[model samples]
Target: MDTILDALQEGRLFELLDNDKTDALQFLAHIIEAFPEVPAGTDVVGHVMKREEAMNTALGKGWACPHARVPFDEDLKCVIGWSPEGIDYGAPDGKPVVLVVMYLVPENQRNHYLREISFLARALENYPGLDKLRKVEDLDDIRNYLLDLIDVSKEPSGPDTRARMIRLQARTAPETLVFQDLSNLIVEPVTLVAGQNTEPVVLTQNHALFEWLDSVKDLIGRIETEGVYQNGGWRVVRRGAVNYQGSRIVYDCVAFKLIQNRPEKYK
Candidate 1:
C-alpha cells in the first residue's frame, strides 16, 4: 500500500484522458514505460495487454490494477491514472473504473508486490472515501487523499524538516506537473532522487540552486548539492532520467540512508 501511495507521492499520479478500458490501460502502461526502474526496450504494453486478455484486472468499486512482470530485479514500481469521468472497464460488477493502478513487477519484488496489493485490497474494502475520490478534481486533493490512507502522522517529520516536507505535495494544474509550492514558479527538468531507502523525493522550485547540476550532469552523475529536503544525511545517488506522461522531466535516483553531521553541506 505504501509503495503505491509513495508512487503517487513522487508524481507518478496523472489525470487520465477519457477513453475505453484498453486505451486507459495502454495509457497507464505507456507511462510505466518511462519509469527508470523498467528496462529499456521492454514491451510494457504488449505484456500488460496480453495479460489482460487472459484475465480482466478491473477491481470492482472504480479501481483497476493491471500489472506486467519483468525479468529484471528492481523495486516494484507503479503509476496511477485517475479518471474523473470514469471509463467503461468491463468490470465484473458492471462498474466504470476510475483509478487505474498499473504495476511493473520485478523478479525480486513479486512477493512484496503481492503483499502490498493484498493489503490494499483489504484496506479498500473498508475505505470510506470512494465518493470523495470520485469527485477529486485537483492533483493536490488526490495526493493528500491517498497519503492519508496510511497516516504518516506518527513518522516524526522533525521540526527541521517539517516545513520542507509539507511542500512535498506540490500543487499543479489539472493535467500538468506545474510546481506551485514555490508560488507555482517552476521546477523544470526536475531531478528526482528516488528515495529507495530514505525520504521519497527532493523537488525544489529553486532551480538556481541546481544550475551547476545541469552544467555538470554529463560530466558527473551523483554530485550532492546543498540539501533541499535532504533528510537523515542520506546519499542520493543519481541514476538517470524518467520521462513521464507530462512534459516535465524526471530523474530516477536512489537515496541510501546514513548518519552524518556535516554543517558545511547545508547552505
Candidate 2:
C-alpha cells in the first residue's frame, strides 16, 4: 500500500498552482525522473495522458487519481500531487480538484495496478475530510493520514478485516453500534447513502481506523471467551498503546451514540 507519504516521503508529491495544468503533466515527468523504477521518456507521459483521455481521472469531491501502466524492468512507483485550493480539472462536478494521486505500473503487472486503484478508491469512498483538507495547513499531516488509511486496508484476513466486516454487518439496521473494543480509538461515523437507502449504513473513514477497531474487538473477544467467562484466574492487562486520536472504537462509539439519538428517515 503506497501511502500519500509513501509517495511523498522524499518530497515526491507536489503542491502545485491550481492554474498550472502543465505543471500537472510535469509532475508526472518528475516522478519518472525521481524514480528510475518507472520507464523513461514520452512513453510514461503518453501512458498517463492516454489514460486521462479515456476518462478524466478527476474523481469527484475534489480528488483525482490519475494512473497508467507500461512495460517496465522494475516493480512499480507512484506520484502524487495536491491542490488544496482545488484546480479547474475537467470533472463532472466542476468543483476543481484538490488531490491528485498518480500511479505508474509495469505492463506485466496488471494486478498490481488494479490493486492500487481499488485501494485508493475505497479509501476515498467514505473519506470524511474533503472539507477538512480545505483548511489544513500542514502537508505532512495530510500525507501521514493518507498513508495510514492505505496501510490498514490491504490486510486480507486479520482483525482489521474483521472489524470492517463488523461495520459491514451493521448495515442491516437503520441504526447500529459501530463499536470497537479498543481504548482511545479514533472513530469517525460516516453516514453514507444518507438518503438513498431507508436503512442507515455506518461507513468508516479507512482501513487503518478499522484495523485499530479490529484489535479492540480481538481483545474484547479474548476477555469474554478466555478470561472473564472461561478462566478461573485472570487479570486485565493493557496490552497495547492506545492512540486515542485515531482509534476506531472510540470514534465509532461517538457515531453510534449520535445515530441512536437522531431521528431516522423513513424514506
Candidate 3:
C-alpha cells in the first residue's frame, strides 16, 4: 500500500493516452525508465511485455497490474495509469481493464512486493467505490478512489501541493511539465541525475510534484551548499519552476548516476 500510495502522491498516476495493452504498458515503462533507481540500461518495457506474454495481469473489474523485475536492490517503485474508457486487456473476467498499475520490483523487496499486491487485491475487491472509478472523468477523482482503497492515513499537505496535483490531473498527457524561471531557484530544492561524461536529467519539486522527487534523493551522494548551488564537483544544468495554481516551486537541478567502484557506502 505504501508503494502504491507513494506513486499516487508523487503524480506517478496518469490519465493513459493509449488504450492498447502494449501501448499502455510501454507508456508506463517509459516513465519508469527515467527513475534514478533504475539502472541506466534496464529494458523496463521489454521485461514487462515479456512477462505479460506469459500471463494476462488484469485483475478484472477494470484493473490490471503489469510489472518488471530486476536484480538490483532498491526501493520499490510504481506508476499508475488510468484509462476511463478502459483498455482491451485480455482479462479472464472478460472485462476491459481501466486501471493499469505497473511496478518495478527489485531483488531486496520481492517478499514485500508480494504482500503489498495481496493487500491491494483484497482492498480493491471490497472497495465500495469501484464502480465510481470506472466512470470518473477527472484524474483527481481517480486518484482519490485509489487512495481511499488503500485507506491512507491523512497527512497535512500544503495548498501548493494540492493545487499542483489538481493541475496535473487536469492536463493532457505530456511527458513532463516543467516551468523555467530562475528567480525562485535560490530558495527551492532541485536534484540532478546523470552519469560520468553523460548529459544529466533534471528532476525537481517543491512539495507540488506529488512527492515522487524524494525517491531520487537516495541516489544523490551529498549536496554541499555553496552560494546558490549544491557543489562537490556538481553544477546546475537546468533551473526551472513547476508552476501550479499561482505558486512556483523552483529547483537548481544538479545530476548523477551510480558512480563506478565507489566506496562501500553505496553498496
TM-scores for all candidates: the values are 0.59, 0.51, 0.59
Candidate 2: stretches off by over 4 Å: 3-5, 39-42, 151-267
Q: lDDT for model 3, on a 0 to 1 scale?
A: 0.62
Candidate 2 residues 176-204, lDDT tens each? 22222211222243222112223322345
Model 3 TM: 0.59
Clashing pairs in 2: 184-244, 185-247, 186-246, 186-247, 187-251
Model 3 spans > 4 angstroms off: 152-267
Per-residue lDDT of 16-69 in model 1, one digit per residue for the tens?
654457666765675566454566568787889999999998878888889999
C-alpha-based local distance difference test score of model 1? 0.59
Q: How should the candidates be ordered by lDDT, best one leading?
A: 3, 1, 2
Worst 10 residues of 2 by lDDT: 250-259
> Would you give me the overall lDDT of model 2?
0.48
Task: Compose the digit string of candidate 3's lDDT tens values, residues 1-267.
Answer: 778666765657767654767667866785676565777668887899899999889988888988899889999988888886789998888989989999999999899889777877877767777888777887767866775555532223223344445445646445342211111112223555444444334455434321433443533233222112223322222222233342322333423222334433222
